[model samples]
Target: MANMQWTLLLLIWMGQCCVIDCQLYEFHYINKEKTWTEAQQYCREKHTDLVTVTNMKDIKRLINISPGNWRGAWIGLYGQTDGTRKWHWSLPGVEFNESEKNWNTGEPNDKTGWQNCGIIWKNLKWGDLSCHDHQYFLCYDDKYILINKNKTWEDALIYCRDHHHDLVTITNMDQQRAVQQEAQFASTDYVWMGLSYACTLDLWFWVSDEVVRYKNWALDGPMDDCDMSGAMETKGNHQWCKKDDTEKFNFICST
Candidate 1:
């Protein structure tokens, strides 16, 4: 009798552990019709809030689950009370982690007078667009294994800066492998990286305020011939160079 009871207890413990380990993360979607306020309310009703991504993997997973037009969904950030344009997550008053705040070139403009709220753009980067714009949004619920979504190089980079830290910087083989796995969905498009020649040093730099730890360039470095004289020149330079924020591309964002 004692042996049988011990066996049953062991089985129960193993089962519980398996159940806990099997919890996977899932991406939820809301149509674009809801205003920011309404979308927030809807998420609350569903027992989840607007999504809060904490890492590159999370960003990718959400993008993969979301469709192209689901751009207008609410995220965790909101305008400050004074309306001076300090954005923050709507969770239980978590401090603004500077390391996680990625901004595009002269972003957070709050172009529209009431652009106090933040939302994910079609490109995956967080932007301070007018709150009234109708676009699909994403929500997340913790489950088992992690999943990531696909993004263009420009959008991915912007998303990383606005939500998480910055475009992923590959330091070593391990980090490279991890980012590659997260970016698997972008097999056709190039995912943006923090590397750029924008600085005086003319070398790559990380946007997260960290030193240049690693680099993986496609042979011969980036070439910049910013001499396109036509209307295209006004847009921005076309460069094989590294770290040009002006160059529009998709990127990953995280908390």
Candidate 2:
């Protein structure tokens, strides 16, 4: 590694002994210094990988983990070496969007030399820099939490965003069981989840961008409508229920 500078960036592995589904992605800040490539390898071996910036919300989280003012770190995005200058997220399955550019004014410029790697700037914007330039970088981890107070789906979402992360997403039985343990203490019959129905698309989706691979719907099946959102029973099988978005209930948040 060359020109490595110090900043906190590292991924601490999660609880393996627990029965709960703690697959919620988390950003870790390690103080260790390394080159961009070294940082990427370290993250992949220690946790998931370098951070992926999906939206402004992710940017805000990245900024929160930042060590100090004017300091920056490597993100998952990088430029093509073929001179196409095409940008791509390092995490597979995440597609780069033309509309998602948060480049600071007149950036990705070659004036700084053959800039190829993407680093998040202190201004909360992305810019191109040398991959060989060592710096502290962010790696991601995962976890979840339960909020016992009752509130509407929208309100619950706001609370989770304000206090923790977004609403929890359960894509498998491991996660379902883990979250269900928290649900048992809910004040309401059902707990607000991140699931929602898109009427135009006519499908249920997780608000956290997780694909609905696994399901635990009630016997009657999911109710699909614009006003419908997902919840989990606090009792019985803890199957998912389709409820109106206006309904109030306890909720889960990822940490």
Candidate 3:
């Protein structure tokens, strides 16, 4: 009886260690010289896409890798002068949903035959603009911080509690939008969200103890994983994806 009890305890302990979740991304810098197209191909074959700089955080990261001299490098940004108007978000996961767009009247005319990027006007309407045009851009600052280190969900939660507040809690669309904006700076396709399922209760809840009343689950909905936790896609629609807690990933913590 004593031996059986000890074995059961050991199993439980192991299980606990296996269910850690995380959210965040990693980056690598290549010093090789190449044009934008070449660099894109190289990054795809060797690493991920050529560093997609979406926010100041990404810019700072790039600056840190500077050669300390007046040397230039190629990034993933380019202009399509072929009169092809393909709308894409400067940020990754927040894809341009045609069904959810608000374009200005007769806008996106590609008036100068060089509008490839997009912007939201003062009226909260979107417009296709010149990719080369230098203009003021909107930046969102959520109270959450992205941790670049890889850790399990449990480990990430503890780190957030010890360092910042706790893992982030998204209660509404506004909060979700804030998180999605923040995620654009992530190095990973998905970042951890403070959501989890309790097998004992057979219910989902946020780590911040907020009721799971609001959700932005992925099109497929949350996957079944009693030992899994929630993460947000950093590339498309910023929907939540269920992943095993044991999977190591970069994470976000609330401030």
lDDT of 2 at 185: 74
Candidate 3, residue 75: the lDDT equals 38
Compose the digit string of candidate 3's lDDT tens values, residues 1-255.
Answer: 111100000011111223112112334444443444454555566544543434434345434543333133333433344455454443345554556545679876778776655554444344665555443332222356788878889999999999988888877664676677777677777888789989888888998776887788888887666898999888878889899999887788876
Cα lDDT tens digits, model 2, 1-255, are 334332333222233423233334456765567778888899889876788776676567457656454377788888886756688888665678989889888888856676888888787788888888877687775366678787999999999999887899876665786588678778899999999998999988898776787899999999676899999999999999999999889998876
The candidate, 2 or 3, that scores higher on lDDT is 2
Best by TM-score: 2
Cα lDDT listed for each candidate: 0.48, 0.76, 0.60
Per-candidate TM-scores read 0.44, 0.50, 0.47
Which scores higher on TM-score, 2 or 3? 2
lDDT of 1 by residue, 1-255 (tens): 111100001011212334222223345665546667776776667644666644555565556655444434567667775635466775443445657765555667878677776776656566776667654555554221112444544555556656654555444443444344334444224445555443445444455444544444445554543311000011122112343344444443323
RMSD of each: 19.2, 14.3, 16.5
Clashes of 2: 10
Candidate 3: Cα lDDT at 89: 42
Task: List residue ranges in candidate 3 displaced over 4 A.
Answer: 1-141
Quote model 1's TM-score: 0.44
Top model number, lDDT: 2
